[model samples]
Target: MATTFQKCKTDEKNKAYPCASTRCKHPWTVRYREPGGRSGRQREKSFPTKTEAVDHGVKMENDKREGTYIDPKRGAVPLKVYAEKWIGRQHMATNTEGTYERAFRLHIYPALGSRLLSAIRTDDIEQLGRDMTTAGLSANSADAYLTPLRSVCKAAVVNGDIGRNPFIGAKLPKLPNKAVDETQLPTGQQIQDMADEFRPEWALSIWLMAGLGLRTGEMLGLRIGDFQEDHVRVSRQITRGKAGQGPVIGPLKHRRVGDWRKIPLPTNLRDAVRAHVAAYGTGPDGALFKTLTGTLVAASDYATHFKKVTKLLGFEWSPHDLRHWFASTALSNGLPLLDVSRWLGHKSINETADTYGHLTPDSTGRAVKVMDVAITQHRAGLVLDTAA
Candidate 1:
């Protein structure tokens, strides 16, 4: 796959009796190409010394045989270019795509975007994370900002754009360990109190998030068609785009198109939906919540509204906190953990447990009491058998 040679300068008669350093600035050159389909792709790199040239040539040949060969020159492609291409091929959700792009533009691009993919070492990636943290971002926030870089580097390695992923086996910043508090959740009455802070059109946001455990985007993306008397179909969300662009409807997090899950519509939430529909008559796209001018509600727009409501009520809870209250209330009331996870649209039961697993101190006492009752019943059955 590669060869090394010395091209010494000839004399005036176009003949060279001996090679010498004085005659040529870079006499040694490594000629390399991939295997089989490497035709017309032959390229060369000049080196100051024969040993350096030959070493690189051998490594290239070995890499080709090992099936991990990439055009050494192609690795020079800027990270931003490769990252854009990599993200484009991924077909990610709109919000996720926007996050990746924003991460690149704000954090990663300025530091490393122009650097060659081949040149970025694990140390550089780790250092960038530290720099972001030192720049006042929390450890978790820094890691979140670096996620796009980590993913892009990983993909580069998989696609052979680079030899290895810098992120793999690298020590990354960790989120601070936190003790879960069950009291973080709000009560149904508390939710209603917050709902009263807004008009019916916007009040439904609080109900859906608190009552149904809907995510902010999912709540904003709700439409009349997605709602039934008995159940609600959760299939899409509102996702932000580039800075100046408006949010668009996209598939639910971690789900593909045409995939949906039904959450049972409770009697109260169902009645609330009907009242709102009767008053507002739905927006142009049958959306349950919208502005007065018949436009789709964006998550950011509603976030601003929620901040105002929190200021007014002094409840100090977010829309997401309402969803958390839904989960906490369900779990505390004996709802199966797996069912709670499903209703919250969590990716896995483990996630639900990690976030909402903390319960009250009396929970274990309740478990023991139930066990006592079971044992008593078993003893009674044994005595009845003996009597028979």
Candidate 2:
């Protein structure tokens, strides 16, 4: 049950002044218990008139009885507070977690962090995306940047902090074609030119990537024992499993522990690995390559040299481009798409075809030939039947 009463007002001097029933003109205060009748916690709110106060009190009691009551305070929590907690609960790679944290700090916090969870409107979210695009990020990049916030809002809905996610059906900016552009891939001579910029050990690493179509992390995680005369075993990669911890030896991308794949070793690649082994011996635990100081060749450390050489060579390319070059070269040389996918250790053959199908050797010519053969056979049969 709820009761209405008028509370005393304060003067400009910050002193309480009492008001009698005859002269009382203060707002009405509604005092009531929470959902469970007398057992529910006592709560209070004030209204300008007796009627509004009575209506709000009745609605509160009924909503609680129906088990649909959401604490007004829960929705008042700041988005930043909730979002930080959300990040802590996610099971993600260290680097990815780091990226999300950086994005939230730089992009989200300044704009909508102070807003209450219930107050964050769909307009605010769509506006944030536009702001990112105006700052020169692609529409796809902006969308990715908003992923953590979008997830946080959805989780809030489930937690009963808000009724619905503001992100649902919002009009975000459009993205362009995402298919791989073969022009970004480096050529054979360009690969060698960049390789020559590194010392022999690291140079061989570049060649292994291009020849075997292996990821940079997979190449860095190689062991001397993994190399054979005819093939190489890919079993692990250097990765950071948890946020804040440095990279460690982890399973390959898109693979579970103990899963492995093997790629055929061409004669030239085999000779290159042998030459590297002969020259520098090997790092601890049979690691095929490492820094001069014998540390695991980390991507951040390796990228410094890669960037310097690419800048000097007057070309913009990344280590992964070497892998793309290998796939393109193999596809152009008549290797089957399925074989290329296997060589690259892709999760599926369709993945390889989707990215590099345009590079398939003489695809248009082969289609034309097939069509011509079908037409000629049909016409020949028709002519023979007419003659008979």
State each model's CA lDDT, in order: 0.81, 0.82
Q: Using TM-score as the measure, which candidate wins?
A: 1
List the candidate 2 regions with Cα displacement exceeding 4 Å.
1-76, 93-102, 105-114, 130-144, 154-162, 170-176, 240-244, 345-351, 362-388
Q: What's the count of clashing pairs in each model shown?
A: 0, 0
What is the lDDT, from 0 to 100, of the residue 119 in candidate 2?
A: 89
Kindly list the per-residue Cα lDDT of model 1 for residues 315-366, writing each as its tens digit: 7777878877888788888888888889989888888888877742247788
Q: 322 in model 1: Cα distance from truth in Å?
A: 1.2
For candidate 1, the per-residue lDDT at 251 reads 87
User: Candidate 2: what lDDT?
Assistant: 0.82
Which sections of candidate 1 miss by over 4 Å? 1-67, 135-138, 177-180, 360-388
